[model samples]
Target: MNLETFLLKDKIQEIENGFKIKNGWLLICESTYDEIESKGIYCALIKNKYLEKYSSSHSWPINYGYEGKSNVYGDNSYQTYDNEEVEPFLFRKSFNIKDGIKKYIDVGEEFILFYRLFEEVADKQNRVYYFVNDYGELDEVIVVEPNKVKIKLKYLKEYITMRDMHFFISFEYMILRKTIDKDWNLEFIDKDFSNENYFYNHLIRNDMGTYQSWILGNYFIKPNVSKRSYLDFDNFHCEEFIIGIDENGEIILKNPKYESKGNFTFTYFKKEVLNKYYNNPIEYEIDSFSVSNKYFRLKIDNNLENIIPVLLTDLLILPENEQLHWKQYNIPITEDLKLSSTYYKTMILGNWYESPESIDLYFKHLYNDFNKKWYQKFGWNLYKPLAKEDEFNFKALHLITENNIKSFCEQTLTIVKLTIDRINEKEIVKGIELEPNTKGISKFQKFLESKNMDIPDLFEFLRHLQSLRSGLIAHTFSNSNKECKKALEYFNFNERNLIDIQKEIFKKSIRTFSTLETHLL
Candidate 1:
């Protein structure tokens, strides 16, 4: 599509300022900003492909505008960031349906499409303005003069921006069917034009950006009322001036400009809709699977998938009495633990134990329910309402891998160390000030000692993790490194199975948290 296709009157005239197309309906005029003479202030007419940077194999002009100039401004502004070439064939004809009135626009790909109701109020002195209210009914606002109407229209634009667009927009296009069947009202059927687009092509096919067709729903268009008003002065010397001309060769001056110092562009033309109904449904599910052991195999799906995991978890984490209840099913304790793999992917290897998310969820429940008043005294302080940074770190604490071992360790160690430090700092929780610079595992050890607590196994586990980081990550990797070897031996894991050690350590950390919650509370 070329300029001639959409041009109702195809005449490109040379005006005093610059090039005038469609008589004077649209002008590429000379615009001067400040004292600097430049001419790049108008609605750009170019291809849609040029909208995105590095989208096409195009090379843009280097010196079209000054450094740091935005794409929305200056000559060939519509040109690609790197202009391959502004091929004549690249530009296409498009239509913008503003206020029920269809008009032409220039784009490279598909047409820009959307409906805006009440874009411009009629300027006639006797014209009645009906603004869409919260109830989808038009609210009458009478203005005797055109200028007053313009002012109210400007205020209305601001109101739309400040308030919800839904209440102001009409949704008739999406909900209403053209046939006026048993479902839709006759009034809506007459106005709905979306059905035509649903069948037709080469019309207003896409919106300016995303290129999506009009969203489905019921809506009505508000018409454009503000006509093009030009600067009457011939020697139109202003600090800055940007103008938009319609296909009818008239200048629109309703754009916002600072009283003395600022720029002027066209009033934001809006195509609005009113929607009455909306619904979003979840269409997600996981497939069924089987849990097999030496004795039996249980098929799982839906509720089974959801319920079995918790039961298995209880068998591992709950008291002996709880463990006995599941044994009635004739499932071995070891087999049930392995079946946990069906639910949580991050569960410790085949043991199907717990994930970071589950850990956080566990602590959150404990904090919210049990330690509401004394979270700082209990270990729930870290998770009662995790800080934004801590929440981010915790969310990132997923399954360990060779690629993410370093990050996983760093994030895990940070969370644990922070929790320990927070507990130590609380005066309600008894602790000692061993040294000002005490940090990490040593610091945690001192805090435990201050509380007269002895958990040598937990301390050793933390030290092993710290050593892994220090020897393998924080410093440098060496096969002969004793600290690294000790850390690996502590988990009965070797260099090849480092990920396994990380996973084991992660599970231990969760258990350590459980211990903290149990004792601290």
Candidate 2:
């Protein structure tokens, strides 16, 4: 039996058997083309879509305005964006479907298009076909049929079958008003489906009680990452579903909020269908996020690196729930570092600036969203405890050893160096020469002294941190050395408090951000 009859019989049995027949439309997903033709159609559309975009790297020879005998001509002097000329008819003429398929001829001109799926991979599937187009240039047009389809329907099972078939062939889906003819055929009620609430209601199964919650609490959070970032949502469900035709001449729903991974006919609606479609968008909270993998860490923001190369170590965090599955070079899988609770604690209550306006002042003209990553990173990484392996082995791996501490110090000192460089570049402080053949802090201090400016206490704290690092870990010394005792006394830290000392340094580091941000500008 046809899909229409199969669905109609079930509906009739329900109504006749003393069941309440609800007034609703059955939106079915149906493919217009068979599998054999679909591959060709998909290829043609893909090629037409990206031909000019990849014109430079293509091996096709330039045959600009080449007229080889009859009907074989190329585009004259057409230069691509890369300034490379592309010849028309890169694809051979035998691939044209106009002669083989009659329906393709009805649509204006035939354009040969092809795309290699997974071209970079060893096993690539090539799809190519004649794309029908009346318009000179193809935009997102794939299928060459009536895309705005309106069907009369009122059955559930047929819809499920067609929906599953969408994995093999693309099709558009829409439910019109409940209408049927005398011969058990669904009748067309309207030209297009416009009831957004109705469509969302059925898909989301937002029954009478929870329907209002779905409508009122529907909000989308777009992350401040690149378009390719997984955290970035392409068609956040709040937006209307973008309907477009696939390579098959059928309507394919582009971006549905929910999808079925296994493309099979669902046996039960209430149990199978409802569970697959049900999702409470309101429960998606962005405020707090749990790491999706074993561990998560921060990376230095590369925002101003190309221009100034500032060493802002605590300036970016991995996206919430972003998984870090790969093992570090030396760290074994069994002893992988756990994300410290201190990371979360400081991130929640980080005091980076006196006010939000201070942030705006420093990050002026920078992307507004760029600061969000920095805010998360600075808060998380600031209070991270740094120590020798014997003292504290895991949490602060980047700053654990004497050499690593020296490297961290050097990296951290870039903030001061960056500030001075910016100051010199903008002529904020004129005629200042840092002390030669000295440590970074001494050089910075001499530069400040030459400018007749009192050194900030933040620098003094950094100097003490350096002293502690150099004395206890960086320099080779006997356990009872007098210099180690002197360094510990000067920094006001002893062997007992070595592990926790980083917390104080981090607090001091955060206090200086506003000052560095001011001078860097």
Candidate 3:
């Protein structure tokens, strides 16, 4: 039989039996150019009728001549077809129809059948075509072909699923495969499927509820398709059914999430997709980065040296309020020394002028005061001394006497003086040497000359005050009434004033040091 005869008979029989084809039907047959050409002729037969109906409904003049006299028609008769030609309706040229069939045939026989069924309903009331496989379930609707079939099928599937129906259908146009299965469903997979493992392991596995929560609350996916997934999860449903398995033993679905294992993890900083991306410890660049919380706990592998700098950089960027919580206690001061030695070394470097006994006393006072006043305020313990009581033996104290404090203070002061002279060359007031005329005295005299202020005499007086205080602290060994009163009086009378003056001096010193460091760098 001819193609037309076959289609007409089949459709006639279906309509006669009180069975109208639904909008979604699959045609699962191999077709050839000859078959498509035969179907094209059949498609043409009724194309004109749809065109006529469309034009008439839209009040467009028919392309063909009208029959009967003009006076026989009323004034409204021409108006009835006024806009028919302007309406957007399907109009296939003979060549385009032929070409479309040929293209369908190139996709192989099954696609040709789909094309044929698609054209048959192109102008018909019914928009569905069904393909039945005897080996599969009966009443099975394989694929639905329409211009908007994808969206339509999605809505249909959702409506059906909501009604608790077991069967659902989907179409694969690229491969021209039609599937009807009880278990098959739709799901959104990450675009970079290759690195899906990383996302799944790090993000999804820990909290599938997060995905559910996000979808339910935001009605959208987090790290949207345009960003991480590349697949829109909005209005997309997860298929509970596992269609089949691939050679690698992975489940494949009829409408599976299209993901490339290589494109799973997305790195914002790197601006690249990672296939085998992992959350393992690796160097990463961070700009203006900081954690919201105060205390940050880090887990490091056996090797820690490489990660410490990165961690420190992150801590430095934290706000002052936030930074106060980072208590750097129990940190190893040196790799090669005993803890006691490390503690003693830190104490000497941090507060050099204080004797070991004085260091212990100051730390105790500071710690108690901090715990009482600032611990809650700052959320950090700043007065953490390195040495424990057990490490502070009588022998250790004897070994580190007042001489150590005095020597360290003198050496540090000398270095500070040299640094000041080196930086303040332009500020020298010219030629005012002390009586000694030694290198140290000359340098001191030159420093006083450099400053364009009467503050030199004040500085000289403050130096004397510092020298006397140092003498009392070094020689007395005890904060006796005499030494204490002298020390207190000097600090109260001169030390406070000197400290205020030193603020501007320190500012200049810092600027000079920074400039020097920049040049060195």
**Best-performing candidate as measured by TM-score:** 1
Residue-by-residue lDDT tens digits, candidate 1, 1-521? 22222221111112121232332322211222322111222112123243232122112212122212224445645533333322221121223666663322222121111111232235323344344433343433223231111113332222223322211111101111122224322121112223211111122232232121122221111123432222122333322222333433333322123432222111111101000000000111111222223433333311121123322211223234422322222211212133334244432233442321333234333334433534556544433355665454333333332334554556455545434434434333354666666665676666667667789998888777767667765677798889888986776754446445555655676677677667765
Show where candidate 1 strays beyond 4 Å: 1-390, 401-437, 478-482, 495-499
TM-score of each: 0.28, 0.22, 0.17
Candidate 3 C-alpha lDDT tens digits along 1-521: 33223223443232222121233321212112331121110000112224333222212222212211122245444443234322111222222464463211111123225323223243422234433332221122322232222112222233223322211111111111122233433232322111211111001111332221000000000121122211123222331112233322222332213333333111011101110111111222111111122344221111111111112222334345333222211021212222223224333244333211223223233334433443454344322222443222211111111224443333334323334223332223235544553443245445535543234444443344344434543345354545445544544534454333333333333343333234322
lDDT of each: 0.34, 0.27, 0.26
Clashes of 3: 31
Per-residue error (Å), model 3, residue 433: 5.7
Clashes of 2: 6
List model 2 lDDT by residue over 109-147, tens digit each: 222112111111121122212212232211222122221
Which of candidates 1 and 2 reaches a greater lDDT? 1
lDDT at 433 for candidate 2? 55
* Candidate 3 residue runs with Cα over 4 Å from true position: 1-447, 450-453, 457-490, 493-521
Which ten residues in a row are the worst by lDDT in model 3?
212-221
